[model samples]
Target: MSANIEKLQQVISSYFGTSEPIDESTVAADIDGWDSLAHASLMIRVEEEFDVQFPMEAIWKLKNVGEMASLIAKLREGA
Candidate 1:
């Protein structure tokens, strides 16, 4: 797993109390508590953990953990 994925898994585990291992393919629909109500809050926490704000369009584009990690890497690279 990449460092970004590890950190993101930690964030998801912390915020959602998910004990199972999460990987690149994990998505919101795969989690028990990651419903629409919690989506925004989870994103906020993820952004806070990475210390990077996601663009509005990029938010919609993130389909899984890998994509999110990729976007984070790309955004950080541009910084």
Candidate 2:
């Protein structure tokens, strides 16, 4: 895995307090307590971890962990 993905997994794992492996295919339903409100907070945590702001329009478009990691990777590249 890329360092970005490793760290992304770390952040998510820490957030959910789980050691369960999260992959590109992982979705909200795969984790406990991953409701709508948790999704918002988790996104904020992602932005903070990557030090990149997510555009409002793009935030809602993130469908899975892979998309989130891709966006973070792109933002870091453009930085």
lDDT (Cα, 0-100) at 42 in candidate 2: 91
Quote the lDDT for 3 in model 1.
Answer: 97
TM-score for predicted model 1 compared with the true structure: 0.92
lDDT of each structure? 0.88, 0.87
Candidate 1: segments with Cα more than 4 A from true spot? none
Using all chains and alpha carbons, the TM-scores for the candidates as numbered come to 0.92, 0.91
Q: Indicate the worst ten consecutive residues by lDDT in candidate 2.
A: 1-10
Candidate with top lDDT is 1
Candidate 2 lDDT over 1-79, as tens digits, reads 7777788889999999988889888888888887888988998998998999988899888888888899998988898
lDDT (Cα, tens digit) per residue for candidate 1, span 1-79: 8999999999998898979779999988888898877888888998888889999888876898899999998988987
Worst 10 residues of 1 by lDDT: 56-65
Error of 1 at 41 (Å): 0.8
